[model samples]
Target: MSRQEFLVDIVIALPSDLPPERRAELVAAESARARELRAAGSIQRIWRRPGQTANVGVWVAESATELHDLISSLPLFPWMSVRVGALARHPLEDDHQ
Candidate 1:
């Protein structure tokens, strides 16, 4: 079977009672992981949700199961309240390309 690509949108929120030091560690680790994923071409883009302790990104994966694995690998996964969405390509975007 052919592997299909998916676009995943994620939001991460840390617990208010979480320790600052732990937060720092998680952030650093998360950044490193994102870099690795980017290099591997699984992560396309990432941005911080301005004025909030959250982030959003576009990720490409073969399947939702693979995407879940990727997200769960994050160091902050345990502490995060996350929302994920699958995206479909727009006709306009294809025309533009």
Candidate 2:
């Protein structure tokens, strides 16, 4: 099946009282997983929001269910507030895959 494009926005809000060591561990794990996804083409692009623990990415998957699974696989999933939106090509734009 062909993949679909999705705009993903994520904000990670860790508990204030959580141990610093555990926070670092979680962040490192999330970074590693994100790298793997990028290498596999699931993450087309990602941009971090300045002054905030947030990011937006262009992602791809065969279906919304699959996309959800992929996002949920992140180590920081439990601490993240995420929003996903499907994307479609604009009529006036050059062909985009």
Candidate 3:
């Protein structure tokens, strides 16, 4: 089976009013999903930045469409906005290609 990889950058705003335990629960739930995907060989790598408000998950899938679908299915916070983009190309102001 052929697998495609993508760098997924997720940005979310942490709720200031939420308790520490609740925040931990939310992280646990997200980690559970990561485990599920990893077990299925769908996730290649996952990384969380410290003192940052975003998550970066590198995923391996069969196609770009599948990746989009996966991101759409995530249970994100109600006030959060997600931005999914293909990460193959470099984002630069100069045309180096």
Top candidate by TM-score: 2
**What is the C-alpha lDDT profile of model 2 across 14-85, one tens digit per residue?**
999999999989989999999999999999999999999999999999999999999999999999999999
Error of 2 at 60 (Å): 0.4
Off by over 4 Å in 1: 1-7
TM-scores, each model vs. reference: 0.78, 0.94, 0.61
TM-score of 1: 0.78
Ranking by lDDT: 2, 1, 3
> Which of candidates 1 and 2 is the stronger one according to lDDT?
2
Error of 3 at 32 (Å): 1.5
Q: Candidate order by TM-score, highest to lowest? A: 2, 1, 3
| Tens-digit lDDT track of model 3 for 1-97 | 6667787777777679989998888778776776777788776777777887777777877788887677655555453555555546457735765
- Give residue 68's error in model 2 in angstroms: 0.4
Worst lDDT window (10 residues) for model 1? 1-10
Which is better, 1 or 2, measured by TM-score? Answer: 2
Per-residue lDDT over 1-97 for candidate 1, one digit per residue giving the tens place of the 0 to 100 score: 4344554545666878978998888889988998888899888877777877677778888888888898889887886666667777678998897
RMSD of 3: 5.8
